[model samples]
Structure formats: C-alpha cells, structure tokens
Target: MSKASDLKRITELRRELKRHDELYYRDAQPEIEDREYDRLKAELAELEAVHPELSLIDSPTVRVGDDRVEGFASYQHHLPMQSLDNTYSQDEFFAFVARVEKGLEVDGARFTVEPKIDGVAVSLTYENGAFVRAVTRGNGIEGDDVTENARLIKAIPKRLKGDSIPEIIEIRGEIYMRNEEFERVNALRSEAGLELFKNPRNLAAGTIKMLDRVEVGKRQLDIVLYGLGYCQPSVVSSQSEYHRRLGDWGLPVVEAFWEATGPEEAWQAIEKLDTLRNGFEYPTDGAVIKLDSFDQQDVLGATSKAPRWAIAFKFAAEQAETKLNAITIQVGRTGVLTPVAELEPVQLAGTTVSRATLHNREEMARKDVRAGDFVVIEKAGEIIPAVVRVLTEKRPADSEAFVFPETCPSCGTEVTQLEGEVAVRCVNIECPDQVRGRLEHFASRQCMDIEGLGVAVVEQLVSRGSVSNISDIYRLDYEQVVSLDKFAEKSARNLLAAIEASKRVELWRLLHGLGIPQVGAAAAKDLAKAFGGVRELGEASLEKLVELDGIGEKTASGIVAYFQDERNRAIIDALFEAGMNPKAPERPKEGEAVLAGKTFVITGTLPTMKRDEAKALIESKGGKVSGSVSKKTDFLVAGEAAGSKLTKAESLGVKVIDEATLLEMSQ
Candidate 1:
C-alpha cells in the first residue's frame, strides 16, 4: 500500500483503538474480543513501522491506555507499571525471543513462564513492611488509590511475613474474582433483578473502583502478585527469585510456574499451562513468558509502552459452530426475561452444548442471531456458554431474526422494559416460574434454613395449588404435605418441624428470605441490625436505609419500593399472623449498652468462646463485627496467635482487648 493509504488506515485504526481502550479500561466494557483487539493493534503497529513519520507519539501502539476515572485519588507510582506486548501466534512469540537474544547477545537465555491471569492490574505499596495502599495501573505512570477496598481481601496480609522484608516496595499484581465467587455474585444480582456482570474481569475492574468499601467487601476480590514494580533494596535478581520472595512474604502468587531455557521450552510450558488452567480457581487466559535475569532485562531495556524482556501469548477461546434450532425465553425469580439460544447439541469445552445465553433482547439484535442460522459458540470465562457470532454466509435462505416476545412465556403478562435498562421484564408477581424460584430461594439454607424444601417438593406444592407464595409455606397442612408425590409421613413431619423452627430464627434470615431487590444476605444483616425487626425496617425511610454502611442509593430505593408495594405488605402481615415472629437481637438499656455503635474485629482462638460466639456476644450488645481491622475498628479482640489483624490493629493504634476484657465490657 502507498504511504497515503497507510496513513489513512493508521488514522482510522488509532481512532478505533482509542475508543476500544476507553471501553475496556475506563468503562469496563469491550465491544470486540481480546484477539480481535490484538489483531487491530498489531495491524496498526505494522503500518506505523512501515511509515514511522505517520505514527504520532500518543498513538495506542506507543503508550499504555489510561484507566483513571473520577471518585479515586490519583497515585503516582515510584516506577512506571508497563503493560506486556501480546501475540496470538507462536511464530511471533519465537520472533520476540529471537529479538531478546540478539539484543542481549546471548543464546538460550533462561526464561520464566506463568499463567496470565485475566484481571484488573493494581500496585500494592508497602511502607516499612506494612501494607500502606493499593493503586490501579492507570496509564502506567499514575493510578487510582484503592487502599480501603484492597484491605477487604483476606488473602492480602497487612504485614509482610518471613525475614528481609523491603523497607518500601510497590508489589504489582492482578486483582481477580474466582469463578465460584463470580457465579455466587451473579446469582445474587440475578435475584435482585439487576443486569448480571458479563465476566469476572469486567466485574473485578468495576468492583475495585467502587466508592463503597462495604459493597466491595461483600463481593470478595482476590489477588495474585507476580510482577515486581519498585523495590527499595531490590533484593531479587531474577523473575524466579522474585516469585520466591513474594511467596516468602506471604503474598498470593501464581499457582504454577515453569522455568525454560528458551522459546521452545517456553512454548511447551505455555501448552502445559493451557491444559491445566481449567482446574485453577482463577481465570487464566494465556501464558506470560519473561526473561529470567533481571540484569539482562535492564540491559535490553523497554519501549515506551511495554518491556523488551517479556511477552504475553494469548490463547484463542475454544469455540464450536452449532445450528441455532430455536430461541427460548426464561422468566427469572425477578421476572426478567432472559433469551436463550437452543442449539443443536455440539461438544464444547468437555460438555455437550445444547443452549447458550443470548443475554437479552438487545444482544440478540446486536449479533443478529437467527433461529435457522449456524452460530459460533464458546464458553464465556470457561463457565457460561455464549453465542459469539452468527455464521451469516452459511445462513438458510429463509432464515429470520429471533424476535423477542412482548409478553412473558410463563405468564400472559405484557413485558415492560424500564427506562435506561436493557432487561424486558414481566412485572407479574404471580408468574409461575418466578414463584417457583422465589420459594426455592426463600427456603435455601442461606435464607430461612428450611430443610426438605427442594425443587421437586416446591414443584409439587406449586402444581398441586397447595402453596402459591412464601407465606403459603407457613400455612401448609401436614395432611396435604404427606399426600404429595415423594413425601412420606416421617419426611412430612420433619419438613413441618423445620418450617416451624424457621419462624424463631434470627431476624436477618427472615429479611433475606423476603426477597427484597438488591438485599442480599449481607445487606439483610445490616438492615436487621439497624431496624431490629421487619416492621420497623418497613417503616424506615429511604434516607434511613441509605445511611447504612453497605446500602447504596439504588439498594435503599429498592428497599423502599419493596415496602411500598401493598402486595408485599400483605405478605408480611400474613406471615405475622401465621405465628411467624423472627427473633430480633436483644437490645440493652441505654446505660447498659456499652458496646453500642462500635465495630469490633475478632481474631485468633479465644480462651473459651469461639469466634462466632464472640461475634454473637458483640452483636447482642448492639456492636458490629468486621472481618478486617481498620482505623475505624473500635477494638480488636486478640487471643492466642492473633496474626496479621493483631499487627494491623497495633499499627493503626486501634485498641486491643482480650476476651476477658470483652466479657467485662459487655457486663
């Protein structure tokens, strides 16, 4: 191509890549897949190399994309946090190794290969061997301060362990969500009628930048530190040595690593990592190969964007082409209609893939998925099956787009899409599918702890018209239950007894079981602690709800809306009449409640009482229990082997108390 054409293409590519960078980094949304983005960047780099004069200094190829945004203080790094150059092809990877060898003037230089964790990059700063702050990798040079949220991750030690700790250091790593945690959080969001987070990476990116520490804590983010940024003493001399030092310091590091002689061995290691990544708790999208010797790395130097010593080889997502036989709509507990693509069964990721989530109506239109069209499907985040794209070229001549129904399939209710929302929901409270899901959730162990209320039993109860709502569970007749399909006299009696016992459970359980939007188990506990009883909580204003630690404006409004609904009010009233009185925590008289309005963190094994017992004692006296120690912590109850939390409390000057002292204070 001529210089003029190259310039035109480069201009367009720069503009496009910049938009994608904004979507991916600052906004936590990406329109294209990682490989596609890489291809675009790679093309621009080639074009720019051909015509260096056409390349501007601020081009995407020469600089790291900025992730900085509002609501966070910018923290300038002591050393720049650079990104790694990525390649999808093995030949390009070998080329990178060849370049490294030529630059260092050496053959078969040792290398370190480890899984490239798919997560948000952050730098953790330690001062005098104590964790001081956490900062995001915002434009490499400067980042957002997220110390408060980072403290909530239990895996991150407040103080470095082992000997020879650096006086001051910036520990670099990726903050990620485990697959189990991701599914759990998505379940809660689905229950709350909120749009589900698409993947763990996006969720983690958004979560770390959240303004509310309380909300951040509830989701449970974790970290894996492998990169070294700025060290005071610069103890480690190699990548392998740094990893060893990280492990000794009690920092979470990559589960597996491979030392290689050169690119051939590095590729083998990458292949091995790919095979084993499915069993890992965290998401590993690819493998990073870095030159082992720190001296060699320094000598080779780096570009303005990435290091010369390292490269990331991203693995292509496993995909299979399947015929989209039909599209089905599923009504969730919150009445949100999710469109699912029913595919002709094809094997993918060790499972027979018959269905994939189209997510919602908007996604279907964006992808233009049609019923008769062949579609490419892949496991999203190695968990959910999703339709990637439609095979439009091979489409049936008479194929048509999958039109989302205006009414709920489960019920004849007309669906409504709320303003500024993509979800088309069936607002019918009595939708059969929704009722079944709600009943199942209310009876789950996390909520009311009702036993023998499995899906089959709930299905039987609903189908028989013996139970319609959560309130119906309380009013079930023993005779009616015994006569059900699988219920015997003994099982029926146990279930009835369990139902009876649930009435006297802690108030938080009842609150959670009620299925208020945005009110998960954690939020329910906060609400129970603040309001004491369901009746009191119902009468509290939105302002009062928002005043609670974890309860944000959206959650507060959800609570208010739940209470304002006359139907929900009637359910509560009915529950009260059915001998249902959830036991609120005993409130002490003003002078006697010495621990009132204070937060305490319990650590180590106590002399007599267990941690839960100590927590219960504190909560009973109007105090709160926190999982971690912070400046806001009024007291740290210490005992035998009170590890990092005790050290943190001492550092922050938070008062340390023994179990005996706690007992005395309560008395």
Candidate 2:
C-alpha cells in the first residue's frame, strides 16, 4: 500500500473509533459489538506502529474519555483519573512489565494484581471524616459531580469509621451493578415499557449520572475502592496498606488481589484471577497489575493518557464455537418476546454452553445471527451467555436468516412490537403460559409464602382448567386437588390448610402477588404503607401516586394502568370473594418507638433472637439497623464472635449494647 493511502486509512479509522468511544463513554449507547470495535482499534494500532512518521499527535490512542456529557456540574480533578493501557495477550503483559522494570531501573519489582472490573470509574472525595463528594472520570482532567448518587451506595460509608481516617483523601473506585441485579433491572424496564439496557457497564454509567437520587436509590448499586488519587497528610505507604485502611474505615474494597515479585509470579496470579472472575457477582473482563509501592509508582510516573506503573491485562474474551440449531422465542409474564439460541451443546468457561440470550429482534439484526449458522458465543462477565459474533466462514450454503415469528406460539394470538418498543408482545391476557407464570409468582415464598405450591402443581392445575388466574388458587377445592397426579390425601389437606393460612397476609404481599408490572416487593411495601390497601391504590389519582416518595411518573402510570385492566379487576374481585381480604400496614403503638434518632449496627449472632427478629423489633420502634459501623453509629449491638463492626465501633468510641439492652430499649 502507498504511504498516502495508509495515512488516509489511519485517519478514517481514528474518526470512526472516536465516534464509537463517545457512544460508549459519554452517551452510554454502543452501536457495535465489543469484539468488532476491538478489531478496528487493533487494525489502527498496527498501521500506526509500522508508519510512525504518519502517527498523528491527537490520535485516539493518545486521548482518554473525550466525551464530556452535558447537564453535569463539572469539577476539575486535583489529580487526573487516567485510563490504563490494555494488553490482550500474556506476551504483551510481560512486555509491559519489562517496560516498567526498564523505566524504574529496578529488578524483580513487586506488583499488585486484581480483577479489572468492567464498570464506571468515579473519583470520591472525603473531607475530614465525612464523605464530601463524588464525580465521574470524565475527560480525565474534569468530572461530573455525583455526590447524591454516590451516597446511595450502601457499601460506601457516609462517615469514616475507626480512628485512622486522614484529614482528607481522594479515593478512586468503580461503581457497578451485579449480573443478577442487572437482569432484575431489565425485567422491570421491560414491564414498564422502557428499553432494556444493552449491558451492565452502560447501565452503571447511566445510573450514577442520573439527577434524581430517589430514582437512583430504587436501583441498588455497589462500589469497590481501588486506588488513591489524592491524599492529604500522606497517610498510606503501599497499595496493600491502602486496601487495609479502606476496610478499617468501613469501605468496600476488592479482596481478590495478590502481590507478585516478578513477571512469572504476575503471570501465575493473572491466570488465577481469570479463573476466579466467573465466581464474582460483578463483571470482570481482565486483570490489572500495578507497582506495589507508592514510592515506586512515583519513580515510574505516568504518560499523558495512562499511568506507566499500571497495565490492564485484558483476557481475550473466552469464546466457544457452536452451531445455532434453532431459535426459540420465550414469552415473559408481561408478554415481552425474547429470543433464545438453542446451540449444539459445547463447553465454554468450564460449563456446558447450550443456550444464550438474543435480547430482542434489534440485537439479532445487529449481530446478524441466523439459524443453522456456525457462531462464536462468549459469556459476558462469565455469567451472561451472549452471542458475540457470527462465524460466517463455517456457514452452510443453504443457511437462511432466521424469521422471528409474528404470532404467539403458545396462544396463536397475532403479536406486535408495541410502538417505540423492540419487544414483540402477545397482548393476550388469557395466554396459558402467561397465566402459569403469574400463578407461580403469586404463590412464591417472597409473596404469599404458600408452601406446597410448586411449578408442577401450578402447571397441572392450569392444564386441568382448575386455576385460571391468581385468585383461583384460593378457590381450589380440596377433593379435586387429591385427584391431581402427585397429590396424596395428606398432602392435599396440607395444601388446602396452607391456602387458608395465606389469606391473612399483609397488604404488601397481596400487592406483590397481583403481578402488577413495574411493582416490586419494596415498591409494594411502600405503596401499602402509603395507601393502606389495594382498593386505595387502585382508586388513587395519578397525582396521589406520584406524590408518594420514590414513585416516579412512569411507576405511577403503571400502577394506574394495572388497575384499569378489566381482567385484573375481575381477579381482584375474586380474591376479595375468596376471603383473602388484606388490610393496611400495621401501625406501631404510640411512644413505644424508642429507637428513633439513633443508628444501631448489629453483628454476630444473638442467643435470644434471630437477626431478622431483632431488625424487625428495631425498625418497628423507629430505629435504623446499619450494615457497617461508623462514627455516626449510636450503638453497636454486640453478640458472640462479633468481628470488624465490633472493632470499628470500639475504635470510634460508639456505645456497645448487648442483646438484652437492645430488647429492653425496644420494650
């Protein structure tokens, strides 16, 4: 290729990659798969390496997070939260270590290795003993202030614990959502007629930057402190000590880290960390190794983009070759249609990889996935099995693009993707699969606590036409139940007794069991306490629903829409007729709420009461139970073998109370 053409191609690649980076970092929307983006980036890097004279100063390789999202009050960082250099192979990682050694003029330098968490990076500021502010790592030199959102993370302390806190500190951390929590959030979004977030990292970035703290609080987020950005009084000496102090100060710190003395040791640690990534609840894509000593880091210094002392060893995404045998559409309870890939069973990431989510038709189109085509599948975070890309070389000559069915496979109803939504829906309330799902959820332990009601029973009852809706479970005749496939005379009687016991549940349980879209257990409890019963919630105006704390406009509209459904209203009538009438939340007796104006940290095991029992007692009397001890904690409820919370409470000079004292105060 000519030098002019090579230069032109490099310029075009930079332009395209810069746009992709903006979509990813600033807008929280990615147009292409991660692997494709990596390919383009690799191509550009290779071209620039060969033609060093043509390398532009403002190339994508030299910049970090250039997209400054608007609407955030930006603050200039005291110390830049720089990006890390990524290496996809072990050889490259070793090469990075060699460079570090050469730059420092040292031999067998110690390194700290930990999982490279794939999430939003933020800078936290602590003043004295209090959490002062937090900001997103925007454009490296400046960031968006997100102090309100950061406070909602329970893993982070509002106030420092123990006596080791410095006068001030700037901590760097990654705020992330667990894979399971991300799935749950997507479920709620689907129910609320909102678009599902493509991945966890994007959701983390969006959630942290939201203006409304109440909405942020609804979705629980967690964070783990990793490094120190700026510290006053020069308190910490090493990376390992920083972690120890983080835990001592009642902050969430990553525990999966190892110390290594050389490249071979670091290589072994990286392999072990890769294997352990699957077990972590949060997503991790690679391993990051940094020089262990702060003094050493100072000596090595950094470049304009990333620190020279640290390098991120990205695990070449673990993928398996599989054939897409068939595509099946799953009908969720809210009637959203999701496609699942039925693959020829293959091993991936230590497990049999037979199925993966296609998300929706839009995702299927973007990936160009089709039935009978050979494809590459990867576990996103070693948890969510996703089809990363297609292997077109192995495709059969007769292979055809998959046609997503336009009709409901279960009920034969004509389906359509609602306006502005990608999910195709049956829209048929009488669909048998939907009925079975609703019944299953209504009787689950978290809802009605109905024992002896399992999936088999629900399926059998639904198939036999005994249960048509949630209320039909209460109307089940004991004599007819014994006639089912698995029910014995004793078991049938016990099932009937259990059904009778479920009638006296609180309003919150009934609210949750109704299978209302966008309504979760916590939301049900809040609605129950605010409006008292289903009748009140159903009849309340939109203004009243919105007036409640934490109930957003979308949630308010969903509550109104659910009550407006004729079929749902009929089921509620059936519930009332079957003697399952629910009442308002129970009110505590006047003046008995002695635990007000105090925060108590409970640890270890109590002899007299279970943790839940003790927590209920405290909350019923207006006291708050905290997960960790802090200087603001009024008392620490000490029990047998109380651990770090106890030590922190003692060091902070907070009062220590026994179970007896706790019980006495509640009384």
Candidate 3:
C-alpha cells in the first residue's frame, strides 16, 4: 500500500483505539472484546511500522512494551509542600484546636476532619483546565515529575468538567494502590519469583517511580485530591467548600468530610473515621483535622514545616501481645548491631509475625523490653513489624532483665557504642554477620543491582568461605559458584556477568555500598558529587565534608571515622585497585532547545536509558514530564502497552510518541 493510504488507515485505527480506551479506562466500561481490541491495536502498530512517519504520540499500542528512561529530573514546586503537625491523643487534638482558635481570635473553632490516606503524597498542576504536571512530594520543595504515571489514574481528570477553567491550579492529594490491586501485584511478583513488597504503600511508591509508565499503569493506582496548592480565580473560600468544588470539578476527593464545631466534636469525628476506615478501599493511618474557614486558616498561618491551622490525628497503633522467646543481636552491613525480639509465632496484620526489630539499645531501654516478657507488637506503618511495649503485668516471675550484648554476637569481638549514637556496633569488619550484611547491601537495587544475588547466595558464599569481603565477590570462579546448591552453569555465568558489570556502577552507589553510617542513598549522592571521587572523599576532613549541602556534622564525623579505620581504608584500596569505577558521572549541562514545548510519558521497558535518565533528559531540554498522565500530556513516548497511561493518553487525544522519535527530538 502507498504511504498516504497507510497513514490514513493508521489514523483511523488510532481514533478507534482512542474511543475504546476512553470507554474502558475513563468510563470503566469496555465495549470491545479483549481479542478484538488487541487486533485493532496490532493493526495500528503494523500500519505505523510500515509508514513510520505516520506514528503519532498518542497511539494505543505504546502502553505495554519497551521504552525506558534512566532517572527522574528534579522539579521545583510552585508552592512548597508542607507536612501537617500530628496529634496522637485527645489532649493533643484539643491543644491543636485551642491553638487554631487563639490564632484566629475566636472563642470557638470549626474543623473539617477527613481520613488521612496512607499513601504517597503528590501535587498535580492544571493549566487551562487541562492536566499539566504530577509530582511526588520530594523534600517538600522539590519532587520527582510523574505526570505519565499520574495520568493512569482514572479518578484524576485529564480535562476540567466545566468551561470555567482556572488559568492555573495545583491540587494536592494522595496516590494509593488499593488493597485489592496491591494483592494482585504481589501475586504477580510471587508468580515471577520476585520478593513481595511489605505493604501497599511501599509497592505504590516503588511502582510509581518505575521507569516504565506501563508497569505503573497496570498496578491500578488511584488518587484522591485532598488539598489545593495554588488556584487562580479561587473557587471556594473555606476548606469545606474546596472539597465540594473539587468534587464538582470531576476530581476525586475524600469520600466524606465532617465539620466539627470544637475539639469534642473533632474527636468524635476522628473516632467515626477510624471506625469506617476498615470499609474503605484504601488504608488510612489517621484523620486530618483542619480549620474549616479559609480566613481562619490565613490567621493561623504555618510553621516552617507544618500548617498551624491543620493537624493530623494519628490513630493508636495496632498492637498484639506475644511471648518473647529470646533476644538476638544482628549486625548490619555497616557493622551496627541491632537487637531482634524472637517471638512465639503469631499472626498480625495479615502476616505471620515471628521477629520484631528492637531498633537499638536506646529503644530497648526506652521501652524497657525484656526477654520472657509478653510484649505488645505492631507493624510500624503496617510495614516493619516492631515491638511497641512490654506487658509488665504478664511478665514471667522467673524472668530476668534482658541485657544488651557487649560483644559482636557472630565474631565474639567487643562491640563499641559511639558517643551520641544509639546503636552499638561491632568493630570487626570481617565478622561473619558483617560479611553477610555487606554482601546483601552491595547487591541491593540501590547498590550494584546484582540480579539473583539474594540472601541464600550470600549465605552460601559466606558459609563456604567462597567470599569473605566485598572484593571476594569479584574473584568468584564459575565452578565455585555453580558448586552451590541450585546453581546451574547459566545461573553462575549470569551472576559473574552481573558482578563484572557492577564494577562500572557510579561512585554514589559505591559510597552507599560501603555501608557508611548515616550515609544513605541521598547522602551518598551528595558526598559523591561533593568529593567527585571516593578516594578524595575518604581523605577529606570532617569540617570540609560538612560544608556540602545536606551533609551534617554527624554524617561527616561518621565518614571520617569510617575512613580512619585501617580495615575499611584497606577495603577501599582493594576495591579501587580492583578496577571499579570510583568517580561520579559528570553532571550534564542543562540543554536549551530539546524537549521544548513537548511532554513525553515513558512506559514499560525501553531499549536505552533508565527511568531517571529519561526524566533528566526531558528536564534538561526545558520540557516537563510528570509521573501521571493528564490532559497536559503532549506526548506519551510509549514503549510497550504502557497500560493505563496508554488508555488515558488515547482518551485525552494526547500524542503517544515512541523512543526513536523521542531520541530524534532530544537531538
């Protein structure tokens, strides 16, 4: 067929697919059978392939397949995202109410109480009544742009319902994956033999940040707008009115909001929300209580970090008592010793609980937790299982005080507790426990990302003495690796290749992999960027290091202390001599022309670029890509069937560009 004819057919097919996408994703109704829809999508894809010039940016076929970006670029918020003050008890709630009333110079106060969603907080920007940007709340001031991912949420409108579109509007809300969807995702992971996420929140957070927008779309993530950031042509004067207006604008707001006249009424509302929380599709950790009147809110103002007119009344943590069978100490990758409570197996929060983290010596002392005591345990944020308190009344009469170990449990070496630090750590770097922890941390996603290097492999290597230090991993022969149980030749080769490839990882990863105290991923990046290289970082003085952004005295001291240890210094030397890249990637100069006036949504796997890299490329070019797709998506650079985003893009008539097109545009 001629190119013109093919283009015409592709356009017709795209229009048909877009209509179906709107029917399925936006309306939650499917008019066509799955097979029939697939055929249409396949035909369109074929036509586009034959007439490459005809492929537009809003194709339905772009949702599921390939294109991947390297990483997200930083997006500064128009308005700073502030956290709300938390009120844990009735007294605290009352105090908050009193404070708000006093600030407003009123004898009484009214509050709007709504369920505090247990999900990732995000900001959505709309321009000319069309969806523009969706960003994660990163450090309050800056956030990761996730517009494509956000567009996948059917609840978030791509276009305003009425013609009365505000020139610019910012809506703040929670993006959550429902419990049922979380279960489905977990099931898929389990089927794929992958580690299951601890909870919906973690899964949602990880999924949204995925380089593949299609993967995020498949998770059935949803959003509910709870607050307004900046609204031009303000539609409402009070918090209650804002909710009503948001709902009227076809945005998903909280299901119910209660107007409490005073503290007593507020507490009552809180109790009501807690009672009703179990019935909701998503999880809520608490209730948000905010002054109802906008004028009152203005009068109350805000603190540097939180608003004085609003407070979150966190519910009491769920707790269940179980017998503490024993106390054990586990050394972390950094050699920090942590105490674990071995409990009699009991079920809590939909999982079997046998171990709970005691955090450190300070926490143990604070709670006065003891072995042989009936301890109340709860999952912190319904994720990490933790011992909350001890039931003194139910303590065994023969029980003795649980003593914190003074020595490394694995190597039997003396443990040292640093001044002003809560954790007591083993000084022996070669301790068996330390080796296992280090290996695990090294293979972690944020580190070397060595696929298939799980706890079992690390344990086998440690137990057999196949590997001792981090450097030993590079020296592993194929035969030695394959000798372990469940290790096939192919698996062994893959493992070796992964380790070999890991040597090329950036310096920030190497810094984090070192397990330095107080140096997390963010800090590692800062250190790497500040020092330029690991060797320089190792030799830098604490004062000089502390001068860097986000580097505090404690972290600087920790870095200095780590390097001062001859053993750690030797390990660094060995790794450096082993030919691992120890330098940070050079920062790219911000581009001026590329991605200008164009927005792209990356979904599924791409042949090139990690998600962050793709995001950076877009931002460097002066264009913005968001986590979710909305009416703002000028282009959805779909790799695979980019899931809900593909559907949404089709529904909104946004262009769905591909990786090749994206690359060409970037040039």
Of the candidates shown, which would achieve the greatest lDDT relative to the real structure? 1
RMSD of 2: 16.7
If both were scored by lDDT, which would come out higher, candidate 1 or candidate 3?
1
Rank by lDDT, highest first: 1, 2, 3
Pick the TM-score winner: 3
Residue pairs that clash (backbone atoms under 3 angstroms), model 2: none
Model-by-model lDDT, in order?
0.84, 0.79, 0.75
The weakest ten consecutive residues by lDDT in model 2 span 54-63
Q: Give the TM-score of candidate 3.
A: 0.70
Q: What is the Å distance of residue 367 in model 1 from its true position? A: 1.2
lDDT of 3 at 359: 85
Task: Please write out the lDDT profile of model 3 over residues 213-271, one tens digit for every residue.
Answer: 86666778888888988889876789988888888789988877898898888889999
Task: Report the CA-based lDDT of candidate 2 relative to the real structure.
Answer: 0.79
The reply for model 3, stretches above 4 Å from the true place, is 1-70, 105-108, 183-196, 214-218, 347-351, 361-369, 378-380, 403-407, 416-422, 476-501, 541-561, 564-570, 573-579, 582-667
- The residue-by-residue lDDT of candidate 2 on 507-616, one tens digit each, is 88899888887676656877886777888889988998876544557678989999999888999988989998676665567897788657787766678875556767
Q: Write the per-residue lDDT of candidate 1 for residues 1-667, one digit (tens) a residue.
A: 8888888788678767866776678767676667778789889989989887555322442246778765587776877899998888889999999999999899998999999998999999998889999999986766888899999999999999898888899999999998779889888755432346667888899889887787887998999999988888878899999999999999999999999998889889999999998898888888999999999999998876689999999887789998999999999889999989999999986568899889889989999988888999986344568898998999989877677898899988999999967999999999999999899888865578676776778888888888888999999988988997656888789889989999998898899899999776657878888898999999999888866655668789989999999999999999999999898866766777678879898876679975657877897787888655655679999987676567778877889999999999998
